[model samples]
Target: MASIALVDDDRNILTSVSIALKSEGFTVRVYSDGETALKALAENPPDLAVLDIKMPRMDGMELLRRLRERTAVPVIFLTSKDDELDEALGLAMGADDYITKPFSQRLLIARIRAILRRTEARAEPEAPDEAQPAAEPIVRGRLSMDPARHRVSWNGQDVVLTVTEFLLLEVLAQRPGFVKTRDQLMDTAYQDDVYVDDRTIDSHIKRLRRKFRAVDPEFKAIETLYGVGYRFAEE
Candidate 1:
């Protein structure tokens, strides 16, 4: 049974979601605030986290920012229907996905299962050492991406990326100079069968650039094509 941490101030939400997840055979752990959730997570991480954006002391965004520093555990944000900016910002800050308030329990379950499936798929064991070359690292002008290891580096300096960011960057860097439409990226990067808007893709791209730029201030490997989409700069 996979363990899930649910963080939200609303007792009603906690009770409802916890019951639903438990019925699905998930070990549900509920926290009423981000501070408690964060402390518990650092001590023993869960398979997935569902966080509400409006928590006091430490909001979902802040908890995510701090959590990413310690673990790459997948996260899903909960936000109000009108919190468009918060949703985009949460994605930029490395959240895997977000669901607006008044969301259906069925939709939430589907999303959770999708993310879990992806996570499990990614963790599958690798082939024998002799067959390793088949999954070689992707190299592009000082940027290296190892899909087999799920690692990325710029100028030989290691950089951390969330699972979604890693998938998005891998898709672009593997096909340097090829423009990937927002829809294409959505299909490829977010394989959970969810419909994420173009703005979500934009936020992810912006954060991707920021991560690489931190290692190399002259990082220009990712380029935007104005009204079109984005591409990885060819060497």
Candidate 2:
């Protein structure tokens, strides 16, 4: 059974979501604030975390920032309805996905399941086959990606990325100098049943670049094409 950590200030949300997730066979852990969640998360991480943006003590943004420093555990944010800024910021902070407030429990569950599925797929090992060759690490300029291990690095320095960000980068780096339209990237990162807008893709790309730049100030492998999409430069 997958374990889930739900961090929110609202008591009702903690109770209701915990019960719902438990009914779905998930081992649910609830935190009423981000500060408490952060400490517990570091000691014992969960399979995934669902965080609320507006909370006393420590906000979700701060919690996510701290979490990303240590663990790449998948995160899903809960934003207030119509809070586009919060949604974008959360995505840029390494959240795998987000659900707006007053969201259907069904939709929230679906999003959680989809992210978990992707995480599991990446960790699952392929069966040995003599004819089927093993997957090789992708190398482009200073970037290196090991799909089998879900690891990425730049200039020999490790860079942590969420599952969605990793998938988006893999698609773009697969074909250097090839532009991956927003629609194509969305399809690659998100499940067909889940819908995410163009802006979401843009935010993930921005975050990806920011991470790479942290390690290499002159990193310019990812290039943007006005009104077209994005591409990994041919190096």
Candidate 3:
């Protein structure tokens, strides 16, 4: 069974979400603040986390910034504010999804299930014993992405990426010479039963390309396949 951690300062929200998740056959651990959640993750990470945006000890954005430094756990943010900047920032920082407060319990549960499904689907493919050596990290000039480490570093300095960005990059890198359709990328990267449009993906890719270019100008080689999707060209 997939185990998840729910972090929110509101005891009532935490209690309700815990009950909802349990009914869906998930094991849940609830925390009242981001501080405890962070400590728990450092101890033993859960498969997924649901975090509230505003908390007393530590806010969700700060927690997210910190989380990106170490792990790639899929997270869904719960925020009371309907600010677009916060939404974009949260996603850019690596959050999988955001739910505004007064959200439907059903919608939250559905989103969690979708995230969990995608997480399971994106698990690394097995390699043959000989192929194990072939699974070495991908280094394109100064850009290096290490699947084994779940880390991306440019100019020998790590670049903080959200879970979605990491997965998108992984999908592209795994297919060195081939372009991936948006649906294919979504299936491989998200792997959850979801439909992620080109815009959502483009924003992530744009950020990634920009970051890479900032570090190494020649890093814009991530080719957009016109009407298709994206490919990390070996060209």
TM-score of each: 0.66, 0.66, 0.62
Give the poorly placed runs of model 2, Cα more than 4 Å off: 1-3, 12-47, 51-111, 122-134
Candidate 2's residue-wise lDDT over 1-235, tens digit each?
A: 9999999999999999999889989999999999999999988999999999999999999999999999999999999976767866887688887777887675577678878887887777767673445468999988999986778999999887766788899999999999999999988887636676888799889878888888998999999998999999998
TM-score of 1: 0.66
lDDT of 3 by residue, 1-235 (tens): 9888998999999888899889989899999988888988757878888888888989899888888788988888887754656766787688887777787776677677767765665574656763434347888665688765557987797766655677788788776878888877666544435555676577768877876776677776688988988998785
Better of 2 and 3 by lDDT: 2
Runs in model 1 lying further than 4 Å from the true structure: 12-27, 33-46, 51-115, 122-134
N/CA/C clash count, model 3: 2
Ranking of all candidate structures by their lDDT, best first: 2, 1, 3
TM-score of 3: 0.62
Model 3 misplaced regions, further than 4 Å: 9-20, 32-48, 61-134
Tell me the lDDT of model 2 at 29. Answer: 96
Q: How accurate is candidate 1 locally (lDDT)?
A: 0.84
Error of 3 at 38 (Å): 6.9
